[model samples]
Target: MSSFPQIPQTIADEQQLDDWLTTPSSELIEFVRTLSGDLLVLGAGGKMGPSLAVRAKRAIDAAGSPASVIAVSRFSDTTSRQWLDDRGVVTHAADLLDRNAVEAIPDAANVLYMVGTKFGTSQNPAFTWAINTVASSQVMQRFAGSRFVALSTGNVYPFVPVASGGATEDGPIGPVGEYANAALGRERVFQYFSTCNGTPVTLMRLNYAVDLRYGVLTDIGLRVFSGEPVDLRNGYLNCIWQGDANDAIIRALGTAESPHCLLNLTGQETLSVRAIANEFARLLERPVQFTGEETESALLSNSAKCCDLLGAPQISTETMIRWTADWLRQKGRLLNKPTHFEVRDGKF
Candidate 1:
């Protein structure tokens, strides 16, 4: 693997953070050299997509490849579209649900499927299912021959004992809530098409990906910094730095298989909400408050297979905690999107 940029003691501003997040590692640049054609990122307007798309563009450029990075999304947030356009990534405004629009997308040898709805599942279950399942079917059919790395959620697996080190890829799946079931349906659709069309795919089951802006860490840090009582009901979780997650997802393109490879993408350690909040209290020099008790089980995933395959994430959990604490102390910009990870009822 190529050497990564040195981890900063503190990320000074959004510009610095974005630059860090989009910096492609040497391994990624090397992978892009072997990639055949342009890279298409569907649903590129979401929280993680812009950075991922930009990172791919950087990697391709660093590799001196002619492949272009194309991003497709509804782009309800015009700023996201503008951000991609400014970064030398090709931006396309389209609704994944519209079969005609999906068909109109430019062809690519590699596709990263990031389209799915999760936050408003309780209020609009049908829409969640449509975005997760229907949109997946449309994209799978439209790009039947492309090597795909589809984003999936760890929620597809039922909550396992914290001591179990999370659910493995081969374990039985028992999604608890409506959103999770729909997420599973999305995976099934990918599998079905992959079986029929022999499309190579890798389904990445990711839990919380912390970006210092919005993530499990930011959620907990905000609560601690604001003197709000931290909820510990759904105690433990698995998370990866958004940049590391993006790196793994991009690299996994090579591991795509006709049968559809299933890999859990996350940090190795099972993190504790209580411990994290207490650390935040110390960092912020504030008293910690808490409510509820830690549960024996939480939604988690074991990424041993992914680590063995892609090499372990370059960022460490300790570094994420320190960086998150500093970001909160500086009153950094937040997406204001709460992870709601404490909800155990399967509701978003």
Candidate 2:
């Protein structure tokens, strides 16, 4: 057993997903193609989980064979599971804090470690560390043979000076501050796991994966659509569409490189909040309004590593906003449920 750790899956529509599969970037398809044998997707029931699972199923099926895809989650969303099963995906449930569940996962060559906590998750810092930091290490220990890819946030970077371009991977990340506990503790936990076990861990430092649920799109789009004013900060927002994000994760599989890798998951362009809002308004065919107030910090990060190492490409910002806004028009809401990680600072 590695350690104690941790599904609701709801499928929106099969045809909708089918159309999404045809998307130009094909990020998800590319990622899963490199994976073979058993595939285990952590946090498989979450927002990105279902889409990623389906893409994996497609990748495995097209090659004229069967591959076991275990989608792990604590809460099993029957609808989501059924969707995956219809497309040929298996389901597993466990707590990451539990050593037994981690060990119980069928041995696989790839482990997509998507499990994580949020900005103000659990008032108890202990719970955050236990789940985000400690349990993550145990997972790496348990799946040493597997090429591991886990989602990290841009919040790990320290304050950068204004007028600087987006950060490259080489820039020093300051301690996690102004949010929950220090990011140093969380960062160290993963750093230790990667260094000690030689797990081939790829830490993906994602800026903002554009989603209807409280991401870059929802953060600025809603106010624009509702004819409300927005407060602009000097911070630049680097966003990637969630579908592209799902694809990027799959690409991390089969990365048979020496030493652990760190890649920034972000859009190629770093635009200000006001700039994004203006673009969103243009897409929605509405007039843009904004009050410019430069917030001290910018969350810009570079995606050169992903593009260079894995050919992970980003969707254009205008396209991302259009997709999100269209979905909102159809669904009449940003998220079916509230997201806990919703950011108020407009920093990504």
Candidate 3:
């Protein structure tokens, strides 16, 4: 009997929610079995949190005992709370930044630190560092003996490769923009976890997560179908479907028993920005035109490690693009969607 709350059939329904669920896999089931106690998912209101929480419930159900799932989130509304309650997941709405607040989290034997911050506002650094870094450190310290699966981004790897391209887990973190510190926050948190043998930390360095709400595929589709101009850049990009991303992370947690493990999460194929734009144009029947000079991206990570560690994702990039386009057409967001989200120097 499956106790996992079923994820909605469509992205619109899920995103509107207080919460959503990721597709569960066999490997994920195995990982949940290894856990000795309840699985706590930090930042459970975010994109993948709901799914992870539900998956935990399913795992517990499979084990024939109700494993506790504590989902910590400040943004989750009543609907989100109800979803967790329906699935028997304990939901907590508290700021992780305060050490006192973080201390409130029951000491979980296994913790998935799924917290993150992007799109920083003017006064966001305090909250960013607090939630992204300090809170994680506090949580790690709180659950000293618990194993932690912390999320990292491929953004840590330098883009376009200055000396050489295709960054490995060892690649120097060369993130750009005012958001650079935000990128480093993951490293700092897990580094704290790495110190104690109690909390073995596994960092998942993810590339672009392909989702309809945001990411490369949707951005390109919006531009092409909306008849907008393409913004070209000089860089090789790697992406994985959001579902695949969830698979990879679940695998990481399942396999990780030692600390200081860092795996890069991305698709095997690398394509230029223009190449992807052209593909979208072909799909949308629009001309792929660019109005900007090719600027270099500072970070591009290699996913060979993840491929070898966790099985390679079965979904192809071509399929990802088609799904994203179809999703947009369904949402009716194609016409006015901006091609490239970022516009630099008066050009796309």
Candidate 4:
């Protein structure tokens, strides 16, 4: 593997940001070199999927591996599909909900399952269930013979005391609200299918993944930049840099097991919203506003296991805050998708 690129003091533009996000680390390249077959990334049009797919492709290319990277999504946004194509990732337009469409998907030796609905759960919960549960069932059935690293959410685990350092993988799970329950259902579906078919699977429970464009840090930094009050109800959270998270996700193919291997994927720290907002204020030269008091518990996860298995995230939370502030200072593009990290009811 070549020498890793130096982390930029500040990302200057979207192209730079994309290039940074999709650059594979030495470890990831090593893993891809030994990867036996084609890598299929389902739901590759979402916020994190494009970068993950591109990163995998870069790794495969860097390692001079023969494996191909195929990204599947509905392609509702043609630009995302085109972006993947431009990056040398094969694109397939398909809705996983349609069994026929899934049936037509090319078979692969490994799969990164990224399909799930989260944002509109309150407004159209049935669709959320269909996408999270039904779609998961369909994909699991289709890819039963392939190894899977399916994306689950930290939301599946109920709120824990902020001082507990987040919930561990073997901890009790009590999913709240429709979206959480459905996410858990997706995991259950993977487990059921894996057990029935003897497929190796890894369920990655990720909390917040911060990219310069959108994330917990961006949400807070944007609020501070705009002079809006950052809510403190859900006081603490955990996040990993999206690049590191993507690397870890790709490397997790090694952790797949017969029934299912559950891993919480995030940074090790239990970050405080108030502290992060104040730091953003300092970096952005803006006065941060605040609303509500810190809660005793929040949706957080313990990723020590992930760090131990795949190595810790290269970027730190402090670095993420700084990058987010700098990105906002330069008027970097925002995805306009709020994480709603403050939501206690879990409606979304």
My TM-score estimates for the predictions, one after another, are 0.99, 0.83, 0.83, 0.98
Model 2 is weakest, by summed lDDT over 10 consecutive residues, at: 1-10
Candidate 1: the clashing residue pairs are: none
Candidate 3 wrong stretches, greater than 4 Å:
1-21, 62-65, 121-123, 162-165, 255-259, 295-298, 332-348
Q: Candidate order by lDDT, highest to lowest?
A: 1, 4, 3, 2
Candidate 4 local lDDT, residue 118: 95
lDDT of 1: 0.93
Residue runs of model 1 more than 4 Å from their true location after superposition: none
lDDT of 1 by residue, 1-348 (tens): 125877888888999999989999999999999999999999899999999999999999999999999999999999999999999999999998898998999999999999999999999999999999999999998999899999999999988999999999999899999999999999999999999999999999998999999999999989999989999999999999999999999999999999999999999999999999988898889999999999789999999999999988888888888899999988899999999989999898
List, residue by residue over 1-348, the lDDT tens digit for candidate 2.
001011012224446534464232434444445556778888787767777777666656654445677888875568777777777778877888899888887788778877776644435556666777677777878887677777777777765654566677789876443332433455566667667777677777877776555476776777787787766654466778676776777776655343667778777776777777787787678777776576656667878777776664445576666666665555544453333223444221
Per-residue C-alpha lDDT of model 3 across residues 1-348, encoded as one tens digit per residue: 112234334445334422333445666676667768877888888766776787667657765655788888885467777777787788888788777888887767778878877554235666665666777777777887877778876655545552344688875676554345565776776775676554577888877776566677777667777777766654356778766676566557655554578888788776676777788787667777675666555346778877887777766687777766657667633323322334321121
lDDT of 4 by residue, 52-91 (tens): 9999999999999989999999999999999999989999
Q: Over 4 Å off in model 2, which ranges?
A: 1-34, 178-187, 212-214, 256-258, 285-292, 312-314, 331-333, 336-348
Better of 2 and 3 by lDDT: 3
Q: Worst 10-residue stretch by lDDT in candidate 3?
A: 339-348
Give the higher-TM-score candidate: 1 or 2: 1
